[model samples]
Target: MLEIKNLHVELEEEDKKILKGVDLTVEPGKVHAIMGPNGSGKSTLSYVLSGRAGYEVTQGSAVMDGVDLLELEPEERAAAGLFLAFQYPVEIPGVGNMTFLRTAVNAQRKARGQDEMSAAEFLKVIRERAKSLKIDAEMLKRPVNVGFSGGEKKRNEILQMAMLEPRMCILDETDSGLDVDAMKLVADGVNALRDDGRGFLVITHYQRLLDHIKPDVVHIMADGRIVKSGGPELALEVEHNGYSDILSEVA
Candidate 1:
């Protein structure tokens, strides 16, 4: 459902290029894992796809189901069925968690011409999903990610994903800084959202998270390009051998 073609992203203030002609495609009902070392431009791919500010699309395009994603604003992209769970979720200290969530949900609904849910109905669904993700009710009333543990922050991102129910979800290190239990919870949240019409692109540094999510395709990215592509077994291989073998090939 998502196609990234010859994508090159560069910082406008500098001559440095972060992504160099990267190409990837993710179809519905599938999960794609991008495993790469630091500075491989994996997060850049997510930000570029989500239309985040400060990243210029110097070359190529990302099209979601034939819609040109670069043409839309960040919120517009979210309204068009795209979600990015950040590697480091920002903690909006002044905004209540549920207040921010309701605003986000209602904004997307308004964009689609759908009727907004009442507070009662939205609370019911959020609570149910939060329970499934093992989030506490008290946690929902506080400021967004404020004073939350790493695990709780991750779960909160997953909760937002569940509420949004986007067609394609880009998880940018959702597994980062989590304990084993928290990682499993994050993975389960992602798996629960899987459907015949939904797809996921999970970016991580290791295969441990893949063990939980069970990706359909595993890609090894190096130097801003996909150096190798394989099935789940490739993830295991990387876990054992590291990126030395793959980076050599790409080099």
Candidate 2:
């Protein structure tokens, strides 16, 4: 469903290039895991894929279903059924969670020429998803991510993903700050979304999250490029021995 070829990206006004000739392909009904050490350009790839501003694409192209993704605006990307779950979710002080969620849903609906959901319908659907994610009803009434714990914020991100039902979903460090229980909750949410028509790119550092998600393919990235690609056993190898051996082979 998504293909990135020779992808090169660099930050604006900076001399250093972050991503260099990275290539990846994700098909529907499968999960792919990207594991890399610090400063490996994992997050940069995420920002670039999601169309976050200020990250200049120096070369290459990312295509989704025959469309050039880099050429579209951020909202345009989202409207095209792309969703990015951030590593650090920002808190909005004045916007209620429900209100923020409803606005996003309605905006996408409008872009797709669908009617805006009434408050009653929106509330009902959100309630169902929130319940499945273990989000309290009271929490939805508060400002977006305000005073939420790290796990709570991550769960909120997944909640948004479930509500949007994107065709391709990118989870950036989704298990970074969660406790074991919280991780299980988030993983369950992701597993529930696995279907024949959807794809997931799960970016994480540890094998623990991979234990829960069980990606169909595991890729090791280094120095701004994907150095090694393998099956689930590769993740287990990384878990036990780290990236030293794989780095040697790839180099």
lDDT of each model, Cα atoms only? 0.94, 0.94
TM-score of each: 0.98, 0.99
Clashing residue pairs, backbone N/CA/C < 3 A, model 2: none
Instruction: Write model 2 residue lDDT over 43-161, tens digit each, in one string.
Output: 88999999998898889999997889999999989989999999999999999999999999999999999999999999999999999999999999999999999999999999999
lDDT of the structure predicted as candidate 2: 0.94
Q: Write the per-residue lDDT of candidate 1 for residues 28-85, one digit (tens) a residue.
A: 9999999999999999899999988888888998999889999999999999999999
lDDT at residue 49 of model 2 (Cα atoms): 95
Sequence-dependent TM-score of model 1: 0.98
State candidate 2's TM-score: 0.99
What's the residue-level lDDT of 189 in candidate 1? 93
